[model samples]
Target: MQARDTTALHTAAATQSPEPGKKRDTGVRGTGTQIALARSETPAEGTRHLTGSRILCADLPRTMARFTTGTLSENRAMLIATEVQDLGQEHRGWADEQLTLNPEDFAGESRKALGDRVRALVQEIEPVTALERIDDARSRRFLRLIPTGNMTMRLIGQNPAEHGVLMHQVLSDLADSKTAAGKGQGRTREQIRADEFCGLVTGEQNISPRVEIELVMTDRILFQAEAEPAYLQGYGTIPAAMARQLVRGRDMELKLMRWIRRTGALDLDPRPDLRDPGLPEPGAAH
Candidate 1:
């Protein structure tokens, strides 16, 4: 909820301090939290860097582009450069399963499972990010993209490498893949990948099995305040609660913005001088 620009988040990487037989996080977890999971370097036994706890942010320049066009906030496009981070606890269970598979087999199955899982993650991400913009206490009852409160697509025999490759591709697809919304046509899984790999060299970097991701968040945004939609570098817009969860934090810095006339109340019903108090507020009596 703090209004400060989160652009710094894009370049922020989790850092680790080597502890003999253990590890220490530099700032990835910040002063009071544990963000070291992703930025960890195995210092020694009983200690290792945790990888993958994250919050994908929007690329800053692209966000400003939207702002200049004045279309950024419209259609909730502020999220164009944004995406979600933080895999759910459910992902932990599944991810652990991937580690169980043999290297090659594990790679393939894990990658596919990852593809499907990451895809589903994006679906959940969009609504969460969208909800962050909704602080209108006037309507507590609103339709939001909530998790069915259940996880989907749990398959066995999936390999880690499979997940790595598949997750990268599928995540790539959702990053830039467009939807018809009202057009009725949707991209098939194959179609999605075809479009995603268009610019890639398909070598080790493009098709590498292991990759890394960084996550950052605020009470008001699911990902960064801005990002690159073309590269589909990050996920997509997310909600505040989701953002906090992604950042591996237990709370958020909630800041709300509002408007009032010097005389008394707002003369214009829908004024732009608005603030998001970070929670649903009671609306005027109907």
Candidate 2:
């Protein structure tokens, strides 16, 4: 569908006339096709999808045939497409033939295995292009935080394999030390490593004196031991008991501000301000 849309847009643009000194204006550039397809959210995501679609439609007939026949998955097809993109048309077609020659060979292959095979083939076919692709990949390394439910977040990143291995080793060593010292009792090595990573990044174990973490909840949840959950800003909903534990564990000082009512909903300011004495400080003794 995306390929068809792209081709139709290109044909339509080719027939249109340009202004005096300007190029013909076509909306199907960059993420325009992605938006038209409504398949991806970001431009990078859209471009990746479109690139895969174009490569399969225009360059890899055998692979496309497998994809159409449900023998190959879209993800694996896209992986192959992306791997062969830097090759010349003739070489790209050769790669397509080499990869898809044996349909039965892909039956139980994992995506990682398929990707590694494609990469190895690309290296054997053209070493210079393979090196260039490696450099390009290195230049595009990034880290992003994705919020998961239950007041947790997922940290996703890409880095050189060496650096990643070294970082993992360091975290493992720290976790082991904590385990030996009986500091992280009852926690798994993975959990301790995660805690150590957070401590190292946030300086919570060393330099951080007092960090402000926000937890918003209703008056009943905060004071009356209600069952309602509290919202931890930047994370997600956490149990009322967990929220109270955070305040009590951190020895946080709480000051109650004015209760603003809007549209029959009460808004409580969770931020602590020393000057605001509208209500007495709530005891964190729950």
What is the per-residue lDDT of model 1 for residues 174-226, given as tens digits with 9 covering 90 to 100? 43434433321476655554444443434323533323333333212322322
Tell me the lDDT of candidate 2.
Answer: 0.66
Question: Would you estimate the TM-scores of all the predictions?
Answer: 0.17, 0.57
lDDT of 2 by residue, 208-258 (tens): 222334567666555455555555554444455555555444322343222
Segments in model 2 whose C-alpha atoms lie over 4 Å from true places: 19-22, 30-37, 140-157, 173-183, 188-190, 199-286
Predicted model with the maximum TM-score: 2
Cα misplacement distance, residue 248 of candidate 2 (Å): 53
Instruction: Name every residue pair that clashes in candidate 2.
Output: none
Look at candidate 2 and tell me the lDDT of residue 284: 22
Estimate candidate 1's alpha-carbon lDDT, on a 0 to 1 scale.
Answer: 0.33
